[model samples]
Target: MVKSGKTKKKYHKPTKPHHHLNPPPAQANKPISVKTLPAHLVLEILYRTPVKSLVRFKSVSKSWFALINHPTFIKMHLDFNTSKNDKNKLICSCGYGTFIDIALLSLSEEPMNVLRINKDFTERPNYPRKINFRDFSKNMVLAGSVNGIVCLSHSEEMSERFVVLWNPSICCWCPIALVETKSWDNMSVGIGFDEVINDYKVICIVPEFRFEDYGWSRIEVYSTNQGSWEDVDKKGKIHFRPNTDLNHCNFIVNGVPYWAGLDLRPGYVDVLGRIDPFTGLFKKIEHPKHVRNEITRVNPVKLRESVAALIQSPGDYPNNVIDLYLLDENTTKWTKMYSIGPLVSGNVCEEMQIPQCFSTGEIILETWTWDTDQDHVTDLDLVHNIYDPKTKLVLHINHMQALHPCWYESYSHVESLVCIKGMVQIGKEHRDKKTKPKMKNWTEFLSKEFDSVLHL
Candidate 1:
């Protein structure tokens, strides 16, 4: 329902900025310098402040600046904010009409607006924000989002496709080098955060075709710290392509990017695949075997536990019922967590994509591609429903109405002060970049047997 228009990007101007994050309400009426505050109090205040506010705090004092920019403090802020229920904000994708608007949705009582990913950026010259990526909206695809950085990939007029890593919190972005492969058209790309090394890695999966069949998948990993891409392994036998669906439940857990495995070799393939960015190899795990006939109806997701799958209940209840199976990272065993529903209210849960859950157990559900006379909504925009399992009530938040085939997608994102390295001026200078571009063809596409999707 978010119409693509010539709207300028607007940052969330926190409604209650009347009181600064540093100076609490007790000192709200006066302009007290942060230097006057005690060291312990200053660190505590800065840790709780939002990223946008913390970015400006770099100008307060040399010590305050050093403290905020320090790796210890940044990690402290990210860890602290990760638990705050109200800190949750969703980066939901609006349709690609003339352009795509990746809007941020708040679970709290904040107003909603378009993120405006367009050509006009800020005052900095050659900033990446100025690039009009929407010109190729047809092939514009989201690789993945990790921490607070979202990586996007698109081919410019059938040329080679490149990757761009963006951190909207600080309005700083950098484009990763273009990935070229002999089987370029069949490659699947994803970006993930390797928490073990504190580095972000971009991975590409390509199935090598030989002897009239797919021999093996050649997997490559790009490390931000090293600023280059390299093959993860020479013999990756389970080199199946990960799911690349824009609306599927592909998520990253503990620095590993997981997508349901989809192989085109004409036999039964594993249901899930997880890549180890550090090691060049990966292992595939089967879906929860306890689901019986409901195995094919299951989807992998990150639940309250580390890695989990949502299984569609076999019962023909009034509404869709989903069960959760948490995979123990240590033991690699599935444990049944809970069920999603039992006709709690509406019957439109079948097409629900991702149900983003805040730290407070409040769930926001977005559904589409179905008709509903229960709500009497005559238009096409999916109803933004809030279902708090604790309260057991579905809160309807109907607003926008767009065309029938609106391709909006949403993913749960946690804001962080993560910074991108090798920042480049993105303007006319990019045209000078050259690479060994390979001819791509549409004959090689990931087999859509089980509808696996991309995750990072």
Candidate 2:
């Protein structure tokens, strides 16, 4: 070794590793970067996700925000959800005599399959996720539900009735012009979609009250696209009734609303009434001959694409079968589809104390026992049963009893993005910031599922 005046260079190791050893394998459990995913694939995964999850993802990036908010994407999401039976739900109102709580029941495909897979019925489905209605309305009637939008009508007896179109999935509401109810009674409210106009419309069929006026309902329609209400029918020919229960499905067919009402003519005739969504015109339909002579009340329900009647067979008090008759819209006649016997015999759809066969082909029977005198409901006993058409067996889901009035009625619901255009301001969560629970600073970065990495 030679020693020079200059300091010797410090020894250092080379960065290149030996060729004998291979680099450690990439982490097997590592998450894939969203950047690596094609935008179309990312969209495919996202639109199928639950709405709650999608809401949180809006802050991800500008491209994501645009994609999620696009009208085409929203429609695609709604279509995908509707196509999947498991994604269907029912918006319900339940309470005792006084207070009603709105809840969402998961009408899953699995439960229907359970009737086949589990013969013993040991397995129970997890359903009926509870949602608070206090934020929405109190004592308001659920006028109708369409594509996840609920029409909430609040009317004091003999006063003005206001209607609100609420999309619970997105927690946004659009209020329609109020209907002056001081001059109207026996109002029938319905909500449906209009494919021709590509808009959602809410209709109110109410009879104008006058000293000399006979009982005939006038048709008024509120178009969401217009954001205004228009009285379409002035002839006052037919009258339909609402504000009773969650059986509103009995009134709507193929986005058209129908009701069993009276036609005001020389002599009052019981007629099946419907409102043409496109024309906003009122028309009268006749009851099936099988149901007309029976003297038993019939339920006008949406069957396939037309209106159908569920008629009790023979006599009402003592009956052995119930017939389902489909309507030939063009002929204005009824054709018998099938007869439900022994399994669903002697039951009326609205007496509601008896079993009712729905267009979904399930015979559902719900019973409620209320403890009341002159005041509010103190306690309740509710039992719900389902009759499987295929198996011809009735499943007594359970006999549930609860304190306080817990009477709940479920209406048709679909998970959708409608009524959410430029209107997704966070609901109670953002409105009640002071009441929100205190979360850790670090936890804010984590995704809702906790499986996600820090968003920021």
Candidate 3:
């Protein structure tokens, strides 16, 4: 009846389902529970992990990788490894490359055990026999160690040289060209951390050789982030010797590098030069009045398993007596701490200063003096001695003819001597004292304490 007209109930399209276009509530993207893990628990877990895991963990998840990659985390891992008893490791470099030998030295009533680090160990890394030189010479300088990362630099070859950076822990290396080789001088390289930039820097100092510009030195700094070397402008009256001994001129402290020089005057007085990576500037640092004379050599040392130091010595060759100066992080001051004495002539004849020092107030030393009168080359009085500066005691540790590298790593602690094929731990053989003194051979006694690091 209707006017067929009226739309037979015009039907609107079925109402579309009103599903919101928003993502499914973000799946409650809750953060990881790393924050919930107790600091001690997290540190404990990290302690059992190796450096490679730590480096890779940074990308696992923002929270995880960040927590694990933090410098603080690395530091915590180091502290935990160190505190778990005295883990001593001896690292050496020779024609064969760098080798690390681990020994356990527990402070308490634990027995000494020599733990073996297999080529496959998680914490230990094996290096190639002949490390390829990136751009420079065959020689490399072991600059400093921080959080298990050993910093090193390559010297320019006498023929053609380049500089490189390496971290032994992770087996990471980067070689870079020396920007200002035009001077054709044997350049010097130094590495340290620049706090201002929170980056590590490598400094190369090329002494200007032209007689006209006698004391002038051209300096360049390599920044890791920038991946380039930049020349630093500095004004100082420096005297140049065509072939001067440049080894002692540069040193690293608390991540900053320093250069040592003399007055540059007629008879230049020894001057210590420091480079501030932040300002890219160089300034002379006055030595403690006590260290003025004495053909001094300033170099870095592993003050402990974790700390870096500037070790000053009047001399390390042939001198039976050696003194140590530790770098103070807060003050940037070199504190003269201990001396290995005038050994009764027969007791010790020749000595090589061991560069490693530990907070335990113990130091490792090496010597090669012999009474047999054997040819200097053949004569073997090589002895590794543990010197306790706190107690004024020195114990013969190991012996060899000519110890190579002279420095190496130990577990969480720095090690000096181990019974490697070419090396020998002769401490047990030379028990000279039939009578046990009060202090006794605590050094030898330490061996009986913690033999090796083993997991229970």
TM-score of each: 0.70, 0.69, 0.56
Measured with C-alpha atoms, the lDDT of residue 281 in candidate 3 is 73
Q: Tell me model 3's lDDT, rounded to 2 decimals.
A: 0.47
Encode model 3's per-residue lDDT on 1-456: one tens digit a residue. Answer: 656655567778988787766645565475446445554555567667755576676566645544553444445566666454354333333222433232233232232323222222232122232324221223444444333333444433422244555444434455555544365366555665566656667666667757887566766677776877664554443343212544322334455555556546456555556666776676654445444234444444455432333333454433434556655545757776666565536433463545445446466565555554443343554466677756788875433212433333222222211111111122222225466445433233222112121110
Q: Candidate 2 overall Cα lDDT vs. reference?
A: 0.57
Q: Sort by TM-score, best first: what order? A: 1, 2, 3
Give per-residue CA lDDT, model 2, range 1-456, as digits (tens): 877798879989879956745444665556667546654565678768988677678788645555555566677788888777567655556555444456655423322100011112222323112222332354466666767777666544211445667776666666554655434445557787787867888787666566465564567788878777766645444454332333232345667766566665645666777777788877777777763444465666554346667765434544535677888888887888776553332222222333223435565555454555455566655666665667876676532222123433345567676653223343342344457664344334333432121122
- Any idea what lDDT model 1 has? 0.59
Model 3 Cα shift for residue 368 (angstroms): 2.5
**Worst ten-residue run, lDDT, model 1?**
447-456
Best by lDDT: 1
Q: State the lDDT of candidate 1 residue by residue for 305-393, as single tens digits.
A: 27777666545544367666779776778888667765335433345644444445555555653445776544444555666667677
- lDDT (C-alpha) at residue 57 in model 1: 78
